[model samples]
Every structure is written in structure tokens, then in C-alpha cells.
Target: MVVANDEGGVKPSHGGPAVADAAPQVDHGMLALTLGALGVVYGDIGTSPIYAFREALVASSGGNVAEREDILGVLSLIIWALTIIVTIKYILFVLRADNKGEGGTLSLMALARGAFAHRPRWILLLGMLGASLFYGDAVITPAISVLSAVEGLNVVTPTFEPYVVPLTLVILAAVFAVQRFGTASVASVFGPVTALWFLSIGASGVVHIVDDPEILLAINPVYIVYFLANSPEVAFVTIGAIFLAVTGAEALYADLGHFGRRPIVLAWLAIVFPCLLLNYVGQGAFVLSHGGIVGHPFFEMNEGWALLPMVALATAATVIASQAVISGAFSLTRQAVQLNLLPRLEILHTSETQSGQIYMPRVNMLLGIVVFMLVIGFQESTNLAAAYGISVTGNMLMTTLLLAVVMLKIWKWPLVAVVALTSMFAVIDIGFFVSNIVKVLDGGWASLAIAFTMALIISTWMRGSRYLFEKTRKNEMPLGFLTEQLAKKKPQLVPGTAVFLTGDPLSAPTALLHSLKHYKVLHEQNVILSVVTAQQPKVPDQERARIEKLNDLFMRVTVTFGYMEQPNIPRALAICRKQGWKFDIMTTSFFLSRRSLKASPTSGMPLWQDKLFIALAKSASDATEYFQIPTGRVVEIGTQVAI
Candidate 1:
């Protein structure tokens, strides 16, 4: 049975400690967390007003008169989409399926996958596709968000038109460059600036919304239903754009662990939802008064004097949102590495106190390259819209499918409740997915291409890892046999503890056996250490380490860390002291086996895939640094593997 970390973590099904879900008392701590969630979690949806409405209206009118019905219908669709997709489906439903209080596509997958010891491997395929889609979204978010924000300069004068793309490229380069400093340093300012952004947009919308109060009629569901009934073709095309309003809905769940469910939910209900509603309404009002301001309805809503200031705030807000997605990608990569779906990557912990704040140089550099290319290539937010819609919608659909498994199999909800809820979600999600599918020829193919490439890499890595595990195990001797032979050999007893790091706890580590063969010496105490990544996001300190005596001189030590956590073998070993095992930091030596992977024609995988696997392993970060082991006390043994 699984148990979750207690207090700030989730409780496992095996009656482990649970993070409290009780409402916090009125305090600055609670308010600060809520405000922080506002800045990070809602930035994408918050900035959607800059482009979503204009794009949808353009699709609806098709350059004809922007009739009142068309404006109201699009507005009505945007309103209800946000309500059901973001508010009900995500915040209320998917967030509850979190793994140890961590919610994301991979976390949800781990939680569901952990519930069954045996199941079809195809289930993992869905999770991989979701993660791949997230990468596509990551590349698009910064490009579209910054491009749309900078496009506001066009309203001030025609002079800024030619320079928009160049300016956006400069801003993106600087933003990616600062990722190494970590979010903790900048998050304090992000919250307040975002708060101001919401206030300004709400007030801006209020100005137009009050003048044309008739636009408020769009909030009624009748307009949406009637519009679709009367003009099915128009409604179908328009909704492909309307889906933009809730594009960042998954962020609410993906970022749940950062601020907790209470803070994220509070931020949405109290701040984000209201402002987004107002801005959308204001856009509708502007469209009604001025027909077909399709290319620039959002900017046109602002008064002339306020245009420049609003543009500046918008650029800052979009930068903040883009940073949020990049950081999420780093976290996702680390989790994938720990789960063995991907090869190990170099992970740098940026914040001393916050484990969640990290920087991945490889991921950062790759994202920077892709984002810059997109900004220059796409050149306009309208063109990038098709690609953005496909990525986000695909991710949303994947979440729904994964949540169906969680609801029926993991959470054990009633069959009727499960069927009804998933069916409703499926209809809406499938509609959005289908609408975006038509745009594949119009740059929507970009997201699909990224997803397919990543899925292939991930699957190949998993398969390669399994093959190596089996190949190595075929030569490994059991611990009992090793101990028996060692007693008979009577090798020289060394002075201190020797810890052998092994991938498999059941078999003898290659390093330990190699040491005996080469030097014919054994330590006074031999500790077989295996660092296991748990399926949960975090394993509590109390349950982190387990110790068992294999014999008088040999002991089996397994240290468990959550996929979200950084592994430190030294720190984990210290926990064994309470269990009657004395661990000394000064004299202990860590033995690590480094494999030299060779691509073979007869390898289980195709020759090209074998080469790809070798390249990934060669670039993988060193195990000693990854496990936080001291360099001075580490020994490396090399092995050749043809897989």
C-alpha cells in the first residue's frame, strides 16, 4: 500500500501521514501564498485577453459585419468554456486526483499506475503523450504571449510595427538567460505586478462594459445555444479560437503542489476568474459598438492615453507567465528522469530552502532555441494561434482520459458518477480537439511533430533501460553466494564502511564484485545501497529509509525518494543510525558503476535507436553529482554494455 508524506504532503492509501486540507486561519502566511499563486498559476489565462477575443471574433465574422448575435455568441462560448473547463473540470475534479498533493500529467499517471501492480503498458502511452504535448505548449507559450504583448505597441503608432518581432526576440533571450537565478528571487515582485494587471484590466473592461451594458446579455447561455443552432458552421470555427480563453487551465492542477489546493483555488475564485470575465465582456462591448475590429479589439478597448502603460504591464505579465511554463518543464524533466522514462539530466537546485526551485541547463537552452525560432518564423500571434490551440487542447484531452482511470479505478467513485462526469468532460474536450485538428496544415502540425518526437525518445529510453537491466542481471551473483564466497576467500578486511550503489537491490552490485576481483580486499562493513524513486511525489522523512541485515557483515539498505525530490545518499544514510546502524560521514566510501554503452547491430532495438540510446547515456549527468555524494569519497568502476 502507498502512503503519502504528512503535514505538507499527501497521505498514501496505506494510512501514511497526510498533508492537512483544513482551511487556514486568517493570517499573512495564507494571504501571501494566495497572492503568490495569483502571479504564477494564472498568468497564462490572465494574459489570454490580449489575443483570444480578437481571434475568435475574426473567425466568427469572416470579414463581414460583426453582428450583435455573433459577438454575443462568441462571448457566451468563452464564458461557459472557462466556467466548465477551468473552474469545474480542473479546479474541482482533476486536482483531487493528485499524487501526494502533486498534480500534473505525470503525477496523475504515477498515481494511477501505482494502484495496479499489473496492467497493460499502453496506459503509460497516454501519460507520455500528455507530457510530450506539454513540451509543445512550452515552446509556444512564450512566443505567442510575448508576441501578443508587444503587438500592443502597434496601437500607439505605426512606427513600432516593423520592430515587434525583433523586440520580442530580445525580450525572450533575456528571459531565458535569467532562468538560472531561479523563481524564488523574482516571485515576490510577480505577485504584486500581477495583482495590478488584474485591477487595470478589470477597470478597463468596466469602462466599456458599463457604457454598453447590453453586452452583458452574452452571459446568458441562450446566446451560445441559439448561435450554434442558427449558424453551426460559424460556431464550429469560432470555438476553435474561443478555446484560447481556457488554454492555461491545466496550470491550475500542474502547479497545485507549489502553493497547495487552497491557495490556488482561492486565487482563481477571488481574483483571476472575475478579471478574465470582465475583460472578455469588455471585448464583446467594443465589438458591438465598432464592427469588425477583429485584428485589435483588445487594444482598441483602451483609451489613447492609457495604451502605452497597459502595453508595458502586459509585456511584464506575459514574461512572468512564460517563465512559469519553462520552470514547469524543468520539473517535469527531472521527474521523468527519476522514473527512468528518460535518461538522467543535470539538475541544478537554485533555491537553498525550496526544493521545487530548479534550473535545467539542457532543457533551458533547448527551449530558448525553439522559442526564438517560433517568434521569428510565425511572426504574428494570429498565425501562432493554431499551433497553440492544438498543443493545449491535446494536453487537456489527455488529462481527461487519465482522470477517467483515476476516478473509476484509483478513487473508486460510483460507476454512474464516473461515467456521467467523464462523458461530459469527453464531449467538450473532444469537440475542442476536433476543432483544432482541422488546423494541422496551418501550423497546428508543429505541436503534433514535437509530441511525436518526444514520445519516441521517451519510449526508446524506457525500452533500452529495461534491456540493460536484464542483460546485467544475467551475470549478477546473489548476495548470499557472494557473502559465502567472500568468507571462504578471506580477503583483507578494510578499515572503513564501503557503500556500493546498485540499480537492483536483489542482485550484487557490479562495483562490489569488481573490487573483489581487482584488489581482493573487502571493507569491515559492506553496505549495499539502492536509491529507489517512489511513485509518489514525496516520501516522508519517517518512511524514507529501510534497513535489513543480510548477514553479520552484509546489510541491505534501500533509500526511497519521491520523483519530485533530489536524491542525497549521504543524508539518507544518516537516517540509518536510529535503526542501530552506525554511519560515519568521514570514512565512508561510495562505489558507483559507470557503464560504457555500445551500439550493436544485434541489439534488441533497431541500430539507429541503439545509437540514440548510447548518445543519451554519454550525455547523462554523473551519478555521483546527481546523488549529492562527496567527490573525494567516490570510486568509479567502468562496465561495457552492448545495448
Candidate 2:
């Protein structure tokens, strides 16, 4: 889970206490939070008007001049997509399914897993798939958003056309480049700037809306029925483009932990929803007045003076949208690492006070490269658009499936109610997914490929980790056996304390056994330490450590951290001090085993996958750095392992 810190940093999830359902006492803090929601939570959906309406109209009309009915039909679809998908499904229902005040794909998966008596394999698979698809969305969002925004230059003048892709690449590069500096300062302005964006778009929308008041009638659901019935095939194709309107709807739920449900709901209803509705409707109005000509209606609707400013504002808004998505990927990556779905990567906390403000250089570099390739390959926003909706739709479908389990098992909702709610969402999700599926040859394959590759990596890492743990356990002595023998044949005793970090506490760590074999001595104070990741987002201090005394010669210490937290061994060991364990860093030496893994054909996974897992293992971050242990007080033992 990615948590947003109280400093208003743009992390994936919020680490602050969950906001109450009751209206917060109106204050500058609450106001600031609401504004922040506008920027980070709603940024992606807020900017959809730039291409959603135009693309739907173009797809419906088959690239020729659009008919009046086609314009109204596409407008009605876009409006209702937002209403049903974003408003009712996400804002009303999905936001309510948060996990302990936290919300995101993995958070929901963790919640759903706890609902069962035993952890189900399918639930884990679903979570992995959802997270993988999110990475796909992460890459595509920046590419499509920036490209579409820069394409607005063509509306300024055809002379600016050649520079659109190059300029977009520069802007995107800058966005990714600055991620190393962190988003704390940049996040401060995200809300205000995004709020201005909403106001500007809303104002432009109202101007054209007044010119053709008849466009208001598109709000009726009857138009959608008529439009679909009249041209079923066109409607099918248009639904994929119409899905662009709600592509970021998942963010509403994903960011539920960040800004809270009330702020997100309020931001959407008061600002984002209204602004998007007006702009989409106004684009329809503008198209109707021009005899159903729909060439860049979002840009054309703004006449001479307003067009340039709108383009500039639109570009800024898209960059913000891209930023939010990239940050989300970082957060999700951390969650995967904690959950043991992926290999450990270097995680750098950007803020001292805010644990949520993190930067993964490897993740940032990978995203930037993929996004650049997308821009170079697609060359136009319309082409990139063809690749966008599939990942988002697939992710939404996975969410719905997981949510049904939550509703039935966790919330204890009636079977009928859970089925009814999920079926409605599943139908909508399936429609959008199937529509996008038809465009597989038209660039949709890119998102699928990315998702598939990520899923494979996650699955391989998980399987490999499990295999290595079990195989290593088979070769280790039980802690009870080791301590009993030590008590009978006491070796030369060292004066200071020694901590052996291992995944399993029941067995003696490899480091401990190697120490006895090489030096023929044991420390006076020996601790068998295991770091455990809890299912919850943040474990309380009271429950952070569990101490078990095995005998005078051995003790077991377990430190628990929430998946959202960074493991600081010293800080956690300090908690042990309260439990009568004298954990002085100066006198304590940490022991760790460094594995040299080699692939064997007899291992469970395929040969290629075994190699991949070994490669991933090699790339994993150093244990001392990851666990925040002091380097000077750590000793490493090497071992050979086959998997």
C-alpha cells in the first residue's frame, strides 16, 4: 500500500489516520486536502475531456463528418460512462470497500485474503494481475496524456504540428527527471493548479453550452439507448473510446486512503464531475453548431484568444496526471516488494518526516524509457489512445472481482446484494474490455504485453522465493536442537550480543551455524530475529515486536511491519527494549547469510524462469541497506543454494 503522509506529499496511499465519514470541521487544512484531491486524485479523469469526446465522435462517424445523432449519441455515452462508472460504481460503492482506511489494488487484495479462513491462491493471483495491469496503465497514462495535450498545438497553428511529439517528449522527460527530487514541493502546487484547470475548462464549457442549450438533453439515458439501437456496431466501437472518460475512475478508489472518501467524493461532485460534464457537453454543443464537424472540438470550442491558454493549461494538467500515475507505480512496487511478489529494489525516502514520499530510481528509469518508446512509436495521440483503455478496463474488472469477495466475506453482505452489485459492474467492465480487445492489432497489444511481462515477473519472484525458503529450511538445524546441544557442550563464549536475521525462527540461521563451525564460539547474548510483514498497512507500536525466550543460550525476536512501512531494524529493535531486551547498537553485531543461487533442472520452475529468478535475486538491493542496519556492526555468511 502506498500511503500519503500528513505533509501533503503525493504518495500512493495515505499514511495519516483515516478521515471520518462525518464532515470534517471546515478549516484551512480540510480545504487544502480537498484541493489536493483535485490535483492528485482527480488529475487523470479531469483532463479526459481533451480527447475523450473528440475521439468518440470520430470513431462513431468513422473519420468523416459526424451526423447530429452521432454527436449526441457519443456525448450521451461519455456522460453516462462517467455517471455510472465513476460516480455510482467508484465514488459510491468501491470507495466504501477500503482496507482499514487504506485503498488500492494490493490493499484490497490483502483485505480480501484476510476474509478467507486460509489464504487462497486465486486471491493472490488476482492481486498480482491487478498490480501488473496498473503498471501498464502507469506507462500508457503519461504517453497518451502528454501526447494528446501537446497535439493541441495543431489547433494553435498547423505550423506547430511538427514540433508536437518532440515538445511532448521534452515535457515528459522533465516530469520523470524531476521525480528524483521528490514531489513534496511540487505536490503543494498540484491542488491549486489542478483546481484552476477545472475552473478554466468549466468556464470555457459554459460559454459554448449557452450557445446550444439543446445539448443538455444528452444527459438523458434514453439517448444512449437510441444511439446504440440505431447503430450497434458503431456504438460498440465508440464504447471503447467513451471509456476514455472514466479511465482514471480507479484512482478515485485507489487514492481513497490518501485524501479520504469524503474529500474525494466532494472534490468530484463539486468540481471535477461538474467541470468534466460541462466540457464534454459543451464539445457536443460546439460540434452541433458547426454542422456536426468534430475536428478537435475540445480545442476548437475555445476560440482565438482562449485556445493558446487552454492548450498550455491542458499540457500542465496532463503532466500532473502523468505524475500521479508514476507515483502510484512507485507505491505499488513497494507494496509488491513487502508482500514478496517482487524482488527488493532500492527505495529512497525523499522526506524525513513522510515515509510515503519515496523514489525508486529503477522504477522511474523503466517508466521513462517505456513512455518515450510509446511516444516515438505511436507518433500521435489518437494512436496512443487505441492502446490506453484496455489496461484500465482490465484493471477495473479485476477490482470488481476482488471486491465481490470483500463484500460477501469481509463486509458480510448478503449473497444477493453482493452478486447484484458486482454483476452490474462486471457487465460494464466486460463491455469496455471487450471493445478494447478488438483493437489488439491497433496498438492495444502494447498494454497487454507490458501487463503480461510484469505478471510473469511477479509470479516468478513469488515462486522462487517460496522454493528457496523451503529448500533452505530443509538443510537447517532446528533452534531447539541447536540450543540443547549448545547447553550440553558450551563453547567459548563471546562477551557481546549477536543478532542472526533469518526468515524462519524455528530453525537455526545459516549464519549462526557457520559462526559456530568456523570460530567454535557463541555470543553470550544471542537473538534469533525475524522480520515479518503484516497484512495491514501500518502495525501499531504495541504489536510491533514479539519476544520469545527459547533458553538461556537462545532467544527468538520477531519484528512486524505493515506492508506500507519501510523496515528499519534498529528502530524496530528499539521497540524490543521496552520488552526487557537490551538492544544496544554499539554492542550488538548483526548476522546475515548471503545466498549464491544456481538453477537446477530438477527445480520446480522451467529452466528459463529459474535463470530469470536468479537474475532477479542478483539485482535485489543489499540486505543491510534495505533493513536499515548499520554497516559497521553487520557480518555476512555465504552459502550456495540450488533452485
Candidate 3:
């Protein structure tokens, strides 16, 4: 996993560190993490019963409630979709593609890119695209989940209809507002509450299943084939809506790192899957018996007194779902920033003990605004449903493709086996993807638009960075050259140490060169420091830093960090003392280089992209603060670069 940086002595860990130690904090017993999974991983899909069935029914049959075949067909589609897509693809396969036991679009992409040894351009594009789609999914999941849950109020009383949108907005607003305060306290109970919610809905559906024990025939694939054959028009539209049943399925894989693979799989198979099947079949039975009950089939399944309680519990479950997605967005933003896909913003760690618990104010604020506007724009859960699933499907499609590369190239699987396994998943994914695409004009485009905009920005930043690196490398002076020049000139030797940050350790950092040139002095001790973020989730403490002494006065130190860990220069510097390198907080002065970027048509990128990159760089998180170096002891040297 360790790849040496010849220039700055930076060593990148491609394979990541030992995972046994990577997840210690989260390595709770299976039962505990399962409870955690039930609370977080399954929240999105768990809340789907709130509107998925009713929406599909309305989309398929409309007022033709007497059509038993349509109901059974929709049921079959839902069942198979959950089995094929959620169970087989994500839970069984994609979950296995963890990056040092972490899963997500970016994580998968990093794994795939690393497997190639050399970064292939297409993998980066796919990763960026998938990551972008997730942001869109993040915004939509909260809006739709909350709106659908609050819409339950309309069933309690027709008088509550007008207030549904406003209530949803207020609830969602409250959800986003509390993010800054952290969810450590509230997150614990989410599992028990969600588990209860699943059981309640399952029981409600089971009670109604007695109305039509014949609905059990839906477990037969023949019914699905027969229904699709008899009613093609209804089946097509129904398939699109049926996708809603597994809307939050991606959360299982996206959150694999939090609860690990086994607990999430256990939670789904033991609790989530069965509950979903019972409730879905129960909804089907209820629809057939009541001739499609009015005002949300899910809420209608509950008898008189149960309606209010059901609504309240449903609201709570949806809130949990929204919370998970919002937190996911925050996590995704941090990943993007660290990977240099996005500009670095302020990152606030919310939990004292859990390294994963982080909050980004800019991401939260932006997500809140978009989700609020989406709620107001869509107006109803049913309407918002049209916008859901596109991004999820897109992300899945990309993940499937990336998984193929991992299986064939990374895992050394036979090409035939890789193609066969990936193709099976691809067929289902492409179906769902196309189904969601039909909804583009109906609101799906909203997510696509957001994704496209993000892809534009991510690609721009990445491309601009590649050009910047190439340009910087082209003009670099060799490390030996700088050292020899210092020795020959015999510059005034200062008392304290100077740590200069550079991306390439072999070259002289512009800041170091500038400092030496201007002051005609060199520190008693000098460090060519390069900070690296590995492709893996968590790098062990033992492998955090690598120090190489090139000569008596100079040392090249490459500090390695896993993507999941934070970067702190002072703390990392302290690690070197154990190995005979004296690191004094008071005596060390950090030097940073700031590039004054100028856009040129003939430079690294188009003028517009160059300008955007410059703006992002200018607004990035402060080097002193980001590195956790003392502000008073840090110095920044500027160098102009044409890009």
C-alpha cells in the first residue's frame, strides 16, 4: 500500500492500512452494530412503505381499483426489485467491494483507481459522476421522506391537508438546524424507534393480509410475468413507481463502514427485509379487500385509533431517514474535499470520541436550502416521488460498472465470471435506471441537473489540479540541487526548525526556496514535509508517518493519513520524536506556499476553469488551521503560477 514519493518523500498508501485497527471504535458486537444499522442504514428503505405502494397503485391503475391483476403485478415487481436490486446487488455483491472495510461511491472509485496502479481517466470520471449523483440523492431523500411522512396528517383529518407542506418544511428545517449540535445523543434511540416502526407497519400489513390470503400468490414469479403480459402500459408505469419500494437501498452499502457488512446484512435480512415483505404484501392484500383504500394505503391500513399513532411513528421514522441522508451528505462533502474533488470548507468534529462524526456548516446550509425549496416545489410526497430514484439508480449503475473492474482486474476473477455476475446486476440496474429516466420531465431532471452541475465542478477542479501539478513539476528544482546550494552558500543557520509543506518531496518547496532566498538563512533543522491522504478508510497509527534522513541537516518526512482520519501536523510531528527526531511545538515554524493563479488561454485549462480553480484555492480552508499548526508560528509564501 505504501508508494514512495521521490520528490518530497511522500509515501501514499494505496491498499490502506490494517483494517482490524481501522474500525475499533465502531467494532461493537454484532448485536450492537445491528441495532445501529437498523437505526441508520435501513431508515430510508424502512420508511418507503409510507408512500411507495400507494404511489405505485395510483400510477398503475388509477381509479380502476377492481383490477386485482394490477395490484398483484405491482406487488411482484416490488418484491423482485427488492430481492434483485437491494439484496443481490448491494447487500450481496457491492458490499463486498469495500475500501479497507468502507463503502461509498468515492470509496469504491478509490479502490478501483488504486487497483490500476496508475489512475485511469475513466475511473475518475465514473467516480466523480457517482459522487455527484449522491449529492443529488442526498437532497431528494430528505425532502421526499419527510413530505411523505407528514402527509399522513391529511389522513387523520382533511383539515390537515393545507398544512402538510408547511409542516414538512418546519420538521425538515428543525432537522437541519439541529445538525450543528450533533446527533450523538439522539442517534442511540433511532434504532429502537425504527425497529418498532418496522414491526408496527409489518403487523398492520399482516392484519390486512387476512383480507386476501390469495395475495400470497405474488411470491410466484408467474404472477409478475402474467401481470406484465396482460397489462403492459400499467406495468411499465408501475415498475417506475415500484422502484420507490427500494429507494433507500443504497444506504446499506453507503454506510457499510459505520456498522460493517455483517451487522447491516443481518439487520436487513432479519428485520428490514421481512418487515418490508410483510408490509408490502399486506398493503397489496389491503388494497384488494378495500378496493384501494383512499388517502395513502399505508396510513389507511391502520384502523381508527391507530391512525394517529401510526402517523406519529411514521413521522419519526422519516425524520430518522432524513437525518441519515443529511449526515451522509456531510460525510460525502468531507470525502470530496479531502480527495480534492471539491473546495475545502470548515469541518467541525461533532463527537469527541467518534472520528466519523463530523459536520460541515456550508454543506448543511446548502443541503437545507435545496431540500426546503424541493419540498416547497414538489408540494407533496407523491409529486416528490417522481424526483426520487434517478440519482440512486445512476449511482448504482456506476457502482456496478466499477464493481466489474474490481472483480475482473483487482480480484483477478476470470473475465467470464466477472461479466456474468456484473451483467446480471447490470440488467436490473439498467431497467431501474431507464424506468427512472422516464420520470425526468416529471421532476427527475432536478436531481440530474444538480448532479451535472456538480460533475462540472468536480471535473473542473480535478482537471485544473492535474494541469497545475504538471506545470509545477515542469519548473521544479531537484532536492539535491537545493541542498547543495544551501551548503555552498553557507546561509545563516537559524536556531529553530523549519517545516515546509510540499506535494513533491524531491523538489524544493517554493516557500522554502523563497524563504532561503529572501532571508539568506536556513534553519538548524529542516523538514521536507508532505501530507498524504490514502485511498483507504483508516490508516493505522503505526503507519501514520515515514521519516527519511537525506543528510545531516535535512530530513524528508511523509505523513500518511487514511481518508477517515483527520490531519494534524503538530500531532503528526510529535510522532517523529519517538524515532529520535526532536519535534518541539515552540521551536517549530511551519512554512506554506500559496500560488497566485492567473488564468491564461494557453495554460493548463480553459480560462474559465482556471479561474474557478483559483477561486476555490483562494477560499480553501486555511493551511494553519487545517494542519492544526500554531497560527502564530505559521508563515505563508506566495508564488505566481499561470494556469
Candidate 4:
């Protein structure tokens, strides 16, 4: 039997047991977290200098050699993009919308949902769109990051050009292959290695900036305006490429729970931002000095003696960038499953101490296959770059819309202030979205296709699950009335406790009804147990389980877990033991209803959708394994249902 836990109405009351406090500020380990943030949170954006500047300049010049103005203009666009989008909008504003120290699309959705007395459907749809877009980003990041880095070999020697794709595939395969072994052993060096990369790239930029001091003029925002006014058509295309520089900016907000706001902000300002700026300016300076020829400027800027070493370092940095995105995919999928957006996939913990270290075989395999196809199809970083930015731009627009609700309702900001802020962000977001939209025929459709597929799956699962719940609830007897009738007429009482798992605690479980019909007997003790997923990230131990004694013969228990947590039925029931329920696993038999669903023409959805839902239901992981319940103690009651 596979059942998704209810994700609503699990919030503890103010008078109830205290919830866990927000993660405390680790002042003592601030340096460690700052370094860690640079490695993980900044890896994606940090690696962008390798291709972002070159692409923008090339786009601005329209395949011809760039003029002095084009070089300065492209650099200016990249600079302000980082400033307004990453620095001002995300790090300054969106990070403040965190839901109890957790920041992500869904976390912000939960916060916005709670701000009002009643939840709004538009807010939920916005969150789903944002999350679905992230899956598109997840698929593209590894492909572009690694390909761009490996393409550096072409600069080292034309002899390596023929081998670039083969070499890239091998490296990408190894990256996904290592996911099962976990990142703990190698994570310690992520900080140091990435730190060195920043220093090297920064120093390289310093050398060229010294040679051509005039390139510093790009730091002014005026050049961006001048660039746009000079040629609107070319500038629009350049803006699309410039958006690449800020593609990973969302990671800064998504990883807020892992490293506190202070460390991430500090890391960007002190290290990541400055280094990226220098490298980009250096690339510009090199191009300008070489008469506006932009041929892999990032690699060509370095001296011949340093070229091979730089390529090696670039490859390692790209791998780290890919690792961060892959891990984020795993984390996001877990949140989706707990919230019932996706079916439960088998999750294996890689680290005993760190609950966040998880491996999902299905997600990993699927990502790997798609990534390989992308590499083979695109065959060049330049082509893959054409497909990037659409998803990130769409996601950014959704975040802006959702953040407006949080600002006006939760923060109690003046509506005027909220509108102005959202309008400013919306303008930038829409511009980027349109710019990328024009690239749909130039490979951007791949991302849109992936995102559309994911959104359809999420919507279908939600609708089908709701229809099943309503249908099941309509036929089942009320728990209150059923227990009353059973108390009045005594039956042969068994010795062990029989716990029936159900989504709707008010309605009697199907397993319980079938058990009584077949055996014509009742257990000495009965537990109506329901597992609930809270809106928050983690529920405290004191508020984990809520118990009520309906009568002497039956007791009701609702065990709550946060969306970020795994549900372990046995461990949760242990909490009931301490609350004087005398719960014993050895003397208990869990009753679960295993439904075999058949598709009907007259169902809530279309014929094909009904079949899809039935397939999804069958593919779901076993309830006994998913809930961490022992196999020997579980009793499955089979039932047939049409949906």
C-alpha cells in the first residue's frame, strides 16, 4: 500500500508543545560557514565568468569582431546585472522572506500561505511554477558548466578539440556515479579548492586590469544605458547572455538554511562578487587590447605557461558547480515528495549524522540520462548556452510575485512600498524573460519542454490524489460513530494492538472495516494513527505527536513531521509510549489498505490521465518500507477501487 501523508492542518497551536526555535546563529563557526557558502552556494555563479562575458560580447558584436564600445557595453551589462539582480534584489530583499530560517520556493509559499487567514490558490500555483522551473535549471546547469570548462582545452591546443566531447562525457558520468558514495569525505576540500580558484582568477584579472586601466569604466551603470540606446536589437540579445552571469543567484536564497544569511552575504561581498567583477573586467581588457577578438578570452587571457594549469582548475571548479546543483535536485525532490507533489522514491541516507545527505537513485539516473543526451545533442557550450536563462528568469519572476504577498501581508509593509519594490523587480525579471523567450527556437525550448512536463505531472498527481481522498472519505464510516457501535456490542477481543493508518482520521480506515468483516473479531486495543506533514521545516520533539483517548477501547494519535523530515512510523509511535499509551512494537500489528486502482472513463480526469495516475499509484514505493515500518508486523488488506 502507498499512501501520501496529509500536509495540512498539522500546525501546533500556541498553547501546544513548543516548536523548535529557528536555527541559532553560529558566531563561533562563522568563518567555516562563510567558506562553505563560497564552495557550495557560490559555485554556480562563480564559474560563470568562464563563458558569460565571452557569450555576451559575441552576441553584441553579431559574430563580427566587437568594437571598443561593444566590449565595454557587454561588460557593463554583466556588472549591473550582478549588482541589481543578485546583490540588490535577491541578497537584500528575497532572503528576508525566509520561512523560519528555511528559504526556497515552497518555503516562501508556506510563509505566504500563513500570512493570510485563508490560503490563496494563486500563491500555490506560483510556487508550483517556480519549483517546476527549477527542475529545468537543474538539468541544464551541469551540462553548460562542465562543457564550457572542458571547452577550455580547445584554447590550450587545437589537438584537444576533437577529444573535448568525449572527455566531457567521461567527467560527467563520474560526477553522477559518485553521488551514492556521498560528499562528506570530499566536502572538506570544496572550500579550499574553490577559494584557490577565486584567488587565481582574481589575480589573473588584476594583471590585465593593470595593463588596460580604461576597462574599469564599465563599472558605471551609464555604459549599460548607452549600450542599450546604441542598438536595441543587439542589446536585447546581449542581455539574454548577460542573464547567465546571475543564473545561480537563486542558490544564495535556497541555501539559506544550510548556511546563515550573514555568511552567504559576507562571502559574496568579500570574495565572490569582487572576484567575478575582476575576471569579467579582465576579459574585457584582454579583448580590447587584442583589437576586440573574443576567442575564449577567459582562457586566452592567461599566459601560455599558465594555460594548462588554469584548464585543470577550471575543470575542478565546474565539477563542484555541478555537484551543488545535483545535490539541490535531490533535496528539492525530497521536499516535493513530503508535500505529496511526487510519489515517494526510495531515499538512502549517505551519512549517519547528517540528515540532509540523501541519495535518490531514480532522480540521479534520470538526470544523468538527460544530461548525457544534452551533451551529445548540443555538442558545444555555445549551443547549450542558447537554452539557458529561460528557466531561471521564469523562476525569478515567480519569486518576485510571491514575495510581494509576503511583504504586504506578513511583513505588514505599506502596500505602496510593496508595489514599488515588486514593480522594479518585475520589470527586470520580465525583460530577462522576454530576452530568453526569443531564444526558444535557438534551443531554449528544451528547458520550456522539461518544465512543462514537470508541471503537468505535479498538477495531475495533486488532482488525482484529491479525487481519491474525496471518494474514499464519502464511503467510509465516521470514526466516532464506528467506535461507539463497537463498544456497545462486544466481540472476540484479540491480545495485540491493531493500528490502522489513514489519511482522513475522521473516517474509519478501510483496513479496519475489512478486518472486522473477515475475522469477526476486534483487538483489545485499537489505534487510529495518522501521519501529518507540517508546513514548517522541522517540528520540535515536544510537538511531534498529539494523542487523544476517544474511549477505553480506542485511542487516536496524530504524529506530525516537518516537510523536510522523513516519516518513521515506529520511531514516532515510541513517543506515544512516553505519553502513557503503553505502546509496544512487538505486541502491535499495523493495518494498511492496499488499493488496486483501475481506470474508468467517467473519472475526475481524462482517460489518459486516469491511466497515468493508475500507473503512478502502482509505481509508488511500498508503504511498509517508505514509512520505516517493520515488514513482519505489517498487515496489508487488499481492496479494489476505480478512479
Q: What TM-scores do the predictions have?
A: 0.94, 0.96, 0.94, 0.96
In model 2, what is the error at residue 350, expressed in angstroms? 1.0
Go through the candidates in order and give the C-alpha RMSD of each one to the true structure: 4.9, 4.9, 5.0, 4.8
How good is model 2 by TM-score? 0.96
Q: Per-residue alpha-carbon lDDT of model 1 for 1-643, expressed as tens digits? A: 2221100011122255656996645778889999998888988889999999988888888874677888899999999999999999988998888898998988988877887776345667888889999999999999999999999999888899999999999999999999999999999999999999998998888889875789999989999988899888878888899998898888988898998998898899998899989989988887777754565877878858888899999999999999999998998898888777777788999999999999999999999999988888899999999888888998998899889889989889999999999999989998998888898988898888888888888888777776777777789998778887776776889799999887666778889989988988899899887777788899888888999887767898878889899888899889889899899988998888877888877668999999887877777778777888899999998878776
Candidate 1 least-lDDT 10 residues: 3-12
The collision pairs in model 4 are none
Task: Write one digit per residue (lDDT tens) for candidate 3, span 229-337.
Answer: 8878767777778888888877887898888899999999998999999999998998888865534788887859999999999899999999998888887777776
lDDT for each residue of candidate 4 in 1-643, tens digit (9 for 90 to 100): 1234422112111156656895655575889899998888988999999999988988999884899888888998888889999999988999888877888888888788777666676887898899999988998999999999999999877899989999999999999999999877678888888999998999899889876789999988888888999999999998999999999998998888888799999999999999989999988899888888888899998858998899999999999999988988888888778777777778888988878778898899999998999999999998988888899999999999999999998899999999999999999999999999999999999899889989998787777887777777789999999999999987899898999988878888999999999999999999998888777888888888889998878998988877778889899889877799888999999998988888877676998998887777777778888889999999999988788
Question: Candidate 1 — what's its lDDT?
Answer: 0.85
Clashing pairs in 3: 7-505, 7-506, 8-504, 8-505, 8-506
Global Cα lDDT for candidate 4: 0.86
Order of candidate numbers by lDDT, starting with the best: 2, 4, 1, 3
Best by lDDT: 2
Candidate 1 C-alpha error for residue 9, in Å: 25
Q: Number of backbone collisions per candidate, in order?
A: 2, 5, 5, 0
- For candidate 4, what's the RMSD? 4.8
Which of the predicted structures, 2 or 3, would earn the higher lDDT when compared with the native? 2
